[model samples]
Target: MKRWIPWLAAAAVVVLVGGGAWRAMAARQQQQKALAQAASQRAEAPMQLAASELVGVVRRSLVLGVPVSGSLRATESAMVKARVAGELQGLTVREGDSVRAGQVLARIDATESQARLRQAQQQADAARAQVDINQRTVTNNQALVNQGFISATALVTSQASLESAQSTYRAALAAADVAKKSLEDTVLRSPITGQVSQRLAQPGERMPIDGRVLEVVDLSRLELEALLSPADSLAVRVGQRAQLQIEGSAEPVVATVARINPSAQAGSRTVPVYLAIAQNRGAPALRQGLFVQGLLDTGRADVLTVPLDAVRTDKPAPYIQAVRDGKVAYLPVKTGARAVVDGQTLVAVEGAPEGTVVVSGRMGQLREGTAVTTAATPSAPVAAASAPATRPAP
Candidate 1:
C-alpha cells in the first residue's frame, strides 16, 4: 500500500504539470486570435482623404521651358528733355497726364532767346546793308576803271573790300538762322502720343539744355526684359510664347519673344531676352517697370506626367503613392523632365499610367495595404484623420 501511494503521487504530479502546460498553450492561442481580430478590424476601416490630398495622372502636351523673371518696360518710351536753357514756363502737365505727338507740353522763358534772335536779326540786317553798299561800290569802281578814271590797282583794292563785306554778310545770315532755331527750341513738344510717367522739372524752375523734364511712355505696347543663363538662352528663339504674372495684375499677361541680345552681359554673362506683351481686351493694364515672372516655353512634349509635388523622395528609391484596388500601393518611377501645364508645374514619370489616382505630398506618408476613400465618400474625416499619419515601414 505504501508503494502504491508513491506511484499515485508521481502520476498526480505528472497530471498537474500537464494541466499547467495546457493552460499556457490555450492562453497563447487566445491572445494571438485577439490580435488577428484587431488587425482585420483596422484593415476593414477605410481612410478618408481630402480632395486636395490626391491628384490624377494626366497625359497631355507638357510645355518644356525655362523659368524666367524680370521687369516690364514700355516698348516705346521717351524722355522729354529741355533743348534750350531758360526758366521753364507754361508747364501744366504732370505725371499721368495724356499727351499727343507734336503737342506743346511746356515752354521755357523765351525772353533771352527772343532777345538773342533780335540781336542776330539786327546784325544780319546791318550785314545786308553793307553787302548792298559793297555791291554798289564794286559796280562804281568797275565803271571808273573801264572809263580809265581810276587806276586798276585802286579798282582791285575796292573789289577785295567788297568781297570781304560779302563774306561777313553771309556769316551774319548763318548766325541769324542759328538764333531762330534756338528760339524755337524753347517751346517743348511731345515727341510721342502717350501718358506722362514722370515730371522731373516744375514750372518756373531754371532748366538747362538736355535736362530731363518729363517721361512719356506708351502703355499700349509693353515688353518684358528677362535675363537667362547661357545654356537656357541658347534654346530661346524669336516668336516663343510665355505667360507673365505682372505685379499688381490678377490675370497673367501673354508675351511673345521679340528679340535676344547677341552677346552676353559683360559681368554676369547672362543673355537678355526681350518679350513683347500682347495687350488683351478686358485685361488689367500693365505699367512700365513692373515686376514680372514666368516660364519661357521652349518646346512641348506629350507624355504621362504628374504634379511635381506628387513625387515622393522619402524612401530609398523615389516612388509615388497610388491608389490601386482601393488600397495604397507604392509605385517605383523613373522621373524625366519637368514642365508646366495649365500653370502648374508637373514632372514626367514612368511606371504610372494616365488617370491613375495618386496621393499628394501634402497627405504625408501612409502605410502599405491601407484602404483609402475620398472625402466625398460616407466615411468621416475624423475617423480617418489618424490613418494618413501612419508611418511607412523602413
Candidate 2:
C-alpha cells in the first residue's frame, strides 16, 4: 500500500508540470498574433495633411549664365604726355582730378620759346626792310635803263639783288612760323574727357618730348577683359548681356559683349572677350585694373521649377516628394539652373511635369504610397443674430 501511494504522488507532480508548460506557450502565441493584427491596421490607415503644406510646381523661363572671371579696364584710356620739351612750370590738375577734352592740364616753361619767337620775328622784320630797300633800288635801276643812264647788264644785276632779298624774307617768315608753333605746344591739354589715374610728372619737373605727365581714363566707359576657352568663345556674341561682380564692390555691374577678338591668345587657346559696361542711373563707381567675375547670359528656356527646399539631396539621386491622388509619390529629377523667382529661390527641374503638387515643407515621416488628406474647404459663416434669420421650413 505505501509503494502504490509513492507512484501516485509522482504521477500527480508530472501532470501539474505539463499543464504549466502548455499555458505558457499559449500566452506567447496569442501575444504575437495580436501584434501582427495591430501592424496590419496601421498600414491600412490613411495619412492626413493640411492643404497649405503642399506647393504646386510651376513653369517659367530660366535664364542660364556662363560664369567667367577676369579683370575690369577702361575702354578709353590715355597717357597724358608732353608734346614739347621744356621745364614743367605749372600743373593745374593732379591725380584723381576730373578733366574734359581740350582742357589745359599743365604748362611748360616757355620763356626760351618766347624769346626765340621774338628773335625770329625781328629777323623777319629786318628781312622785310631789306626787301623794301631792294625794291626801291630795282625801280631806280629800271628808270635809269629807260633813260639810258646805266647799261642793261647793270639793271639786270639790280633785279637779281631784289630777287635774292625776297627769298631771304620768305625764309625768315618760315622760321618765325616754326617758332610760334613751338611756343604754342608748351601747354599740355587733355585729349579726352576722363579722370586722372596717375601723376607721372610733378610741377617744375623738366620733361622731354612725349614724356608721360599723367594717365587719364574714362570711368564711364569701362570694360571687362574676360578670357574664354575656344568652346566658350563661340557661344558669346556681340550684344549679349552680362553681369560683372568687381572685387570689393557689393553690387554687380551690368555689361554687354562689345567685341570679340578674332584670333586666340599667343601660346594659349583662350580668346579675349571684351564686355562693355552699360550706362545706368546711380551706377557704382568702377576703376581700371579691378579684378572682376562675370556671368554671361548665353540663352534662356522655359522649364519646370519648384522651391529649393522641396528638392531632397541626400539620396543617391535628387528627388522631390510629390503628392498624387492623395498618396505620397517620390520622383527622381534632374536639376538645371537655380534662380530667384517671386522672392523665393527656385531650382529648375527636368523630370517633374508642370502642375505637379510637391511637399514643400518638412512634414512628418512620409513613405511610398502612404495615403494623405488635404485640408477641407471652410464653410460659409452664419448670418449675424441682428440680421433677419430665414424662417423654419414649413
Candidate 3:
C-alpha cells in the first residue's frame, strides 16, 4: 500500500508541472500576437495635417529695401537773433506765425538811435558850414595874392585851412551815415520765409547783440536724417528713392536721397544720409523733429519666396518643413531680402522650388520623415477589424 501511494504522488507532481508549462506558453503567444498587431497598425496609420496648417511656395518680384530709422528736420531753418542791442519795444510775430522774407518780426526802441542820428546830422552841418567859409577864405586869398595884396605863404596857409575843414566835414558825414544804419537796425526783420518755431524775447525786454529772438523753420521743404550702419551706407546713393513712415502720418511720405555724408559720424560708425521729402497734394503735413522710419529701395529681382513665418532660423542652417510624397521633409534653405506684399512679409529663399508645399506654423512636435495627410484629403478612419493596406490617394 505504501509503494502504491509513492507512485500516485509522482504522477500528481508531473501533471501539475505540465499544466504550469502550458499556461506559460499560452501567455507568451498572446503577448507576441499583441506586439505584432501594434506594429502593423502603426505602419499603416498616416500622419494627418489640417488644410489651415499648410502654405505654398511661390515666385515673386521682390523689391529689396534697406530699413532705416531717423527723425524729420527742416531743410532750411534759421535762428533769428537781435543784430543790434536795444530795449525790445514790440514783437509783431509770435511762435507758429508764418512770415515772409524781410518781414518785420520785432521792433526795438529807436529813440536813442534817432537822437544820435540828429546829433551826427547837426555836427555834419556845422562841419559843412565851416568848409564853406574856408573855401570863401581860400578864394579871397587867391584873389588877393593875384592882386599882390598877400604873400604866397599866406595863400598857402588859407588853402591848408580849407583842406582841413573839408576833411572834418567828410568825417561828420560818415558818422551820420553810421547813425542812420543803426536806426534802421532797430527793426528786426525775418531773413527767411517760413513759420516761426520759437520766441525767445518779449516786448520791453532788453536784448544784447546777437541775442536769440525767434526760430524760423521752413516746413514746406522737410528732410530726414537717416543713420545707417557702415554696410548699409555703402549701398545708398544720391537720387535713390525711399518711403518715409513718420510718427504721426498715416500714409508714407515719398523722399529722395539728396546727400550722403562723406565720412561716418564722430564716436560712431554710423553714417548720416539725408533724404528730401517731396511735397504732394493731399499728403499729410509734416513737422520738424518728428520721428520716422524709412525703406530705401536698393534693388529689385525675381526670386522664389515663402511666407516669412514659415522659415525657421533658430538652427545654425535655416530650414523649413516641406511636405513631399505624403511625408514631412526638412529642407535646408538660404534666405535673402524680405518684402511686404499685401501686408504679408515674404522672404526670398534659394533652395525650394516654386510649387513646394511647406508647413507654415504650429510645427513644435513635427519630426523629419513623418507620414502626413494633406489638409485637402484627410486620412480615412481606422476600421474596427483592421487598418487598410494602402493609404487613400491625396
For each candidate in turn, the TM-score is 0.72, 0.60, 0.76
Per-residue CA lDDT of candidate 2, range 146-205, in tens?
999999998899889999999999999999999999998898889899999999999889
Q: Return the candidate ranking by TM-score, descending.
A: 3, 1, 2
CA lDDT of every candidate: 0.82, 0.79, 0.82
Which pairs clash in the backbone of model 1?
none
Residues 210-245, model 1: lDDT tens digits: 999999999999998898888788878999988778
73-106 in candidate 3: lDDT tens per residue?
Answer: 9999999887788899769778788999999888
- Superposed on all Cα atoms, the candidates' RMSDs to the truth, in angstroms, are 9.8, 12.9, 10.5
Worst 10 residues of 1 by lDDT: 383-392
**Ten contiguous residues with the weakest lDDT in model 3:** 385-394
Residue pairs in clash, model 2: none
Cα deviation of 143, candidate 3, in Å: 3.3
Off by over 4 Å in 3: 1-46, 147-161, 324-327, 375-394
